[model samples]
Target: MNQSQQPDAADPKRRDILRWTVGLSAGLVLAPLAGCDGGSDDSFSATVDTLPEAPRIVAKNGLIDIDLEAAYAHNSVQLAASAQNAYPGESTQQATDLRSYNGAMLAPTLQLNAGDTLRVLLHNKLPGNDTKYSSLPYLNYQNSTNLHFHGLHVNPGIIRPGVYGDYVVDTPDAGVVPGASRQHEIHLPADHTNGVYWYHPHLHGSTTTQVANGMFGAILVNTPRNDFDLPDDVRDRVIFVHRLNLSDGGRSDNLYDYVNNKNSAFMLNGVYQPTIVMRPGEIQNWHFLNSDVFYPFNPVLDEHTLWQYARDGNSFDRVFRPVNAATSVQMDGRHWPGNVLYPGNRSSVLVQASQTPGTYYLRAAKAPSSTGEEIVARIVVEGRPVEAALPSPHRLPLYNAHQPITDAELAQHGGKTRAVILAMLNKDSDLLVQPIPAGEEWFIPPGDGVSLTDTVFATGNVGTKLAPFQSDLAVTQTIALNAVEEWTLYNLNGYPHPFHIHVNDCYVVKVNGEDIEPYWADTIPLAPNGTSDQPTSITFRSRFTDFTGKFVWHCHALDHEDLGMMELVEVRT
Candidate 1:
């Protein structure tokens, strides 16, 4: 069977799986208030079992060379009982079980410098027949996978010709077929942002399944800027969060089963309620990566203020303390009292241990019932003070600080504006037959008798009929070299989506018509319409100053993206 052929959505065999997987009838609405519990309906009791802390592995040289081989593993988790009453018609308890992964439940951390080259040799050791339970009529290559360097400005593909041609940037084609292996080369520019980034499987059809099984890792790019200075005695920790729902036999029947049943365990660094010992008056830098396929978490450390200085690997001009911190001078529109980490987002926060020692809970203040307000980790401050004074916020050198795009530059070269609407199409939508824009090419999968809507499953371009990093489709939206362009991403979907662009970082200028502090980020959240009829929009500006090639823009909700919500853009010299 052709790998790119569109799956027959109407096939009787396909219907069984489609009914259980593809449809999400309602949109995810934002929960009111910061600490309110969004209640659950399972019957199994929550566990309190805890595991030993996992080791943090940092890269030795400038190169991040590693091998990722898929395999199965067992992990234990403890789900705490809810203090708030369960919502009507919701489950009161849910059981916990061990799940599988590529190796361990969580991959190791891959650390590097700003100007480093990442050479990864990923071996596809996953069983080729893992898709035997799949219901999709087309190729359900669950064992096939690839890697995406999230939030990195790196080349998507090597130069070649024709199908494997140079500058084509074939993102989907980069996948490693089952029983095969592939080498991925990524070069981070000399001035790449210095903070937290991540890597995960991006194979279109099996992305959710692979990531759900824990094929992810952290990539930290170090810098010498004083603004990001930390005390020599301070400990740096990576807290990678994931939500998993395993059955009695320690496996899920389908990729969407976790979504439908709401039986999940929220984990930090692959362990439940892992305890971290700290000294009173000591400060620590905690880097967080939200690798969940769909869930969003707003984290708060009780009685502790989070001094956030970075987002999506890009550091801000000044450190931002929570709005309620006593030392916080003033509140910037971009500053918040807590950190909200959506899917595909990364953040670094400075946490100071209380002067008086005690145990504190670091948990998500807001999350869905499957993993709502659960205690993620425990911080025990039982030792004497390591530092006499509390750490002060640092004013770091921002990325591209010397090449700030001024108003004059905008007026001169930022005239190009592109509008994008993120919407979902059904059987009744006109987009099913909408023609591609004049002179703009549409990516047709390798199969005959496939409709545009059918192509959505194959290419992930439902309402827009666009393809992932297809150079021809992006020609119409070509950006001139070194040009600063303003782009507005409107969310027409019923739920919120995180808009992410590759190869460039953007500063959010306005959201929902309200002016905001221009903060640099590679991923920005697009709010849902809510009760309003009009879709919410966010405007941002990005400078295409450096390298030119094909890259992609898409919803950071990996599931939404896999089902068709990505487009290609080109920077032409």
Candidate 2:
């Protein structure tokens, strides 16, 4: 049943039951956590709707050191709501029914500086993967996993001896099989922007299957900034939106219908409807991550304005001091209403408490067709007021926000524009029955009298055709270093598909042929259009700069990528 159609809204008896299942029962979830001993611990207790902070790992002495294990653990905070997506009568997840990092449902938030080295001992403790599904073009190594720093400009290969970088396109250097250990050494560039990003397993074939079951965390990048950067413990809030796709028996293997289901319940830090308390006139740093496999979140703070500094971990030039005598700096970088965040995306913004002493809500709508908004978090602004100034990009010690690619930069590369298509197999557009395209997953039959033949999307490396992704596949795209190119992504699928690229952020030039103000983004949602002739297109300009080797761009819908919607690329001097 749809969440809006659930009986809890009208039936007071059901509402009482849901409240018990979702709110106070969360206390049972906080018992077994070991490393989550960080953050504030203030709550009303009787009705435990208060927002709980996730366990965190902080960088010390220029390095973030920790051990992260991937295994089946007992996370009591049931991600699925009883009436919305959970199994009937199941309030808490069954033992060993889910997988997570360090046996905790709330993945540890990694707090680090821009130039720090992250050394992690990743242990894979899951049992052997079912090799029956491991085949070419479409593989699901359900028990194997690896790490991908989603939006940081780090090296795509090894960082040092006995350590791996942000590379996940290769198998031997990437995935850690059961009973295996991999030392991950991710080195962020000295100029890496201070914003929000995330870490997740990016092993091919099993990427979506694992992520859909809850296996992701926030990567909060920080830098030295005066008067703006807030403390990590007191006020920084990480809202990770992910689903616990469960079977009827509460196992995490139920993949079908959950991603496409509009009424799926999204958990906030593994809990539902947690309260976020703030004082009047006080501003707190809030970062959001959409870790869901398929849906889009349009986040809105009721009657409050959000100062948006970055999107997808790329800082914007929008936050600045007034050029003219505009005292309020109105609407410059503020999301007065809300913004649409796609899956595998992290948004960094600042939210000030309402001046009025009252109750408000942090709500989100799953796409546009939902019956109404779901209250994700309750913001209680009824404490002593404190005056806090909004941050400006001009005051930061080292602020290198996005500088849009101009006409000159595009002309250097001869204004080359490339086009790629995203679509479903002609036989099936939905995964209700099973995962499609047992083999030849790259085949897209001629639609509307056209396909990616020799004339279009035909790069020399892959040779005049599109190919599904394999770790050892040849680089399909060889981009000239420092050259800026424009790419148009077309979505011919019936549902929305988020396009994401690693290593570099892009300038969003246009959406569906409308010219918008250019902004920096690492991910974008191609509008849905089922027809190939009139597909939805998004135009973005990317400048391959600094460091590069081998990386990938794919559908961030995850399952679509896992099922062969990814392409490999290389940047060379």
What TM-score does each of the candidates earn?
A: 0.75, 0.77
Expressed as tens digits, the lDDT of each residue in 1-573 for candidate 2 is: 222122211133422222212111111111111111222532212222356566545555556767788888765554435223211223454443677787777776666666777777889998886554322323546777888989888888776776888878666224788899888888888677777788888887778767876788777666312124443222556778765666555565422323333334666877666666666877777678889887666666777777666677766564631211122222112211126777877676677878897778676654532224466667777545677777666543334535778889799766877877666644433321133234333332343132321111111121133334642332367788777889887766656677899998888887777777667789877766545567777789987888768888888887677656777888888
What is the overall TM-score of model 1 with all chains considered together? 0.75
Residue clash pairs of candidate 2: none
lDDT of 2: 0.62
Q: Looking at model 2, how many pairs of residues clash?
A: 0
Steric overlap count per candidate: 9, 0
Q: Model 2 segments beyond 4 Å from truth?
A: 1-49, 78-96, 133-140, 160-162, 171-174, 223-227, 230-234, 254-263, 320-338, 366-372, 389-401, 427-467, 470-475
Q: What is the C-alpha lDDT of each candidate?
A: 0.56, 0.62
